[model samples]
Target: MMQVKSVTRIFGQKAALDDVSFAVEKPGFVGIIGRSGAGKSTFLRVMNRMTDATSGSLMFDDRDVLALEGGAKRAWQSQCAMIFQQFNLVPRLDVVSNVLHGTLNRRSTLASMFGFWPDDDVLKAFAILERLDIAEQAAKRAEALSGGQQQRVAIARALMQDPKVILADEPIASLDPMNAQVVMDSLRRIHDEDGRMVIANLHTLDTARRYCDRVIGMRDGRIVFDGTPDQLTTGVARDIYGADASFNEGATSTAIETLGTEGDDAYAQSMMA
Candidate 1:
């Protein structure tokens, strides 16, 4: 279980995360939704230990997440693997090599710097790629792949960490609707098959309602709502986004038909590329 107590992050007198507290008692897919600058990204950064909280505590079981340092901090990072919006892979490197980078924290720097990897790790990387249905692109340069494929490579890298939790910061904000669906489906599959926790910062309400086990709504760096997908009614959305009572939740939806492109270009290219 993970517990966050009174976590607050301050930057130049602005509280990006204000007195945020929550707990994860079980493994499931969690979606965090908010307008821009709502501190959704900041919360994930704090959870992944990419940044420190200005005050309060984060606990994973008995371990104090806020106080970890050096090796322990590195270990925490590995266990709580992060996936970013930009698909943070080395564009010049082959796809498989990028996935293999997930294991760096566990290996000696000399071996990693020399590009020496165990045969087992190599096989595991391929296996993970195969599971994501992108194994054929293993030898291709990451930059050659489409945006959707690159995100899948990112997912494969996260899986290689064998992480207890996956932190995805706006995992699909860049893709068109169809690619967005693919990426969201991949994250859902990882959560279902591996039973690892997935916490994603999402923009589209429809995406969250479809794939998430729970939806957390944030406004101005504070959590405004926490409930199941069905509970996210129009009024609740207004409250979360700080809109007036007449706000339409559909405005935040990225449903396939609404986007008009059919999202097929990258979807087909990813398969045949």
Candidate 2:
């Protein structure tokens, strides 16, 4: 179980995360939704130890996450792996090599720096790529794959960490609707098959509704709602996104269709290039 207690992250006078408290008692897919600057990304970062909370406590299965230092902190970070919007792969490296980077925490610094991956680690990377349905692309350059494929490779990398929790910060924010669906499917599959805790900061309510087992709504750095997807009614969405917000189903569908068309255009352009 992961527990967050009165966690507040203050940036100067601004409180990015204000008195936030929550607990994840079991493994499931969780979606964190909010408008920009609602502290969605900040909260994920604090959980992964990418950023510190100015006050309060974070505990993961009895370990004091906020109090960890040095190697203990590094271990905690590895256990709570993060996936980013940018797909954070080594553009020039092969996909398998990029996935292998996840094992750096468990290996000697000299071995990792020298690119000396053990045979078992290499085999594990292959298995992960296969599980993510990207085994054929394992030897290809990371930059050569489509956006969705790259994100799958990124997921493979995260799995190589054998993490207890996976935190994805807007993993599909840059992709087209088709690719977005693929990436979201991959995340859902991981959560279902592996039973690892998956928490994602998502922009689209539709995607959250489609994939997440639980939805958490935030507004003005505070949690506005927390419940199952069915519990997030249109009225509750209005409260989360504000009365003037345009994040309804109709608007979301239009945006997704537009993004899908744009992604097709970009793919065609890349092929011509």
Candidate 3:
């Protein structure tokens, strides 16, 4: 299980998170939602230790996450893999090599440091790409793939770390509708099939309700709501994003039409009420 206690973060006098505390014991997707500057991304950063909290403790299993330092800190980060909004793959590197980078912490020796990755590691990288169904693009340069494909490659890279948890911060912010589904599906498949823990920061309430096992709402650095996807009512969303404001989801007309066709109106209404 992952636990965060009374987490408070501040920059100058402005609080980014105010005494936020939550836990996730299940192994499916847990989504973080809020408007811009709502402290959604900041919370994800603290989870992965990308940024430290001004106060409170983060723990995984029995490990004191906030106490890790030096090589241990690096390794812990590897164990808790992160995927970013912008696909952070090396553009000049082939997809396979970029995926292989996940193993760097384990084999940062002189020879491995010189790019002499073992054959076993190579096989592992190939297997990870296959797992994400992107082995075909292994040889392609990361710059050559579409935004969706790059994100998938990024997922594969994270998987290569053999992480205990996956943290994705605004991962679909740049994709088109089709690409967004493509990326979300890949992550969902991983969560369901591999049973690894996933924490995603998202903008679209619909996607969060559909894809996440639990939805966590934050505003001005405090957790306002946290519950299963079914708990993400329209009122809840309106509370987070404010009412009457259009939220961009990159949702396709076809996807929305399909949702509307298949009792989505009723589903949405019931939850909202």
Residue 109 C-alpha lDDT in model 2: 87
Candidate 1 lDDT over 1-273, as tens digits, reads 888899987776577788999888999999988776677888888888887888989989789888899999999999999998899999999999999999998999999988899999999999999998999999999999999999999999998999999999888888988888989999999899889999998876787789999999887678899999999876776667665444345753333213211121222223342
Q: Identify the runs in model 2 with alpha carbons over 4 angstroms from their true place.
A: 245-273
Report residue 50 deviation for candidate 2 (angstroms). Answer: 0.7
> Candidate 2's error at 234, in angstroms?
1.3
Q: Model 3 scores what on Cα lDDT?
A: 0.79
Lowest summed lDDT window (length 10), candidate 2? 257-266
Query: What's the CA RMSD for each of the models?
Result: 7.7, 7.1, 8.3
lDDT for 241 in candidate 3 is 57
Residue 162 of candidate 2: its Cα lDDT? Answer: 97
Give lDDT for model 2: 0.84
Structural similarity to truth (TM-score) of each candidate: 0.90, 0.89, 0.87
- For model 1, the superposed segments whose C-alpha errors exceed 4 Å read 244-273
* Model 3 Cα RMSD, 1 decimal: 8.3
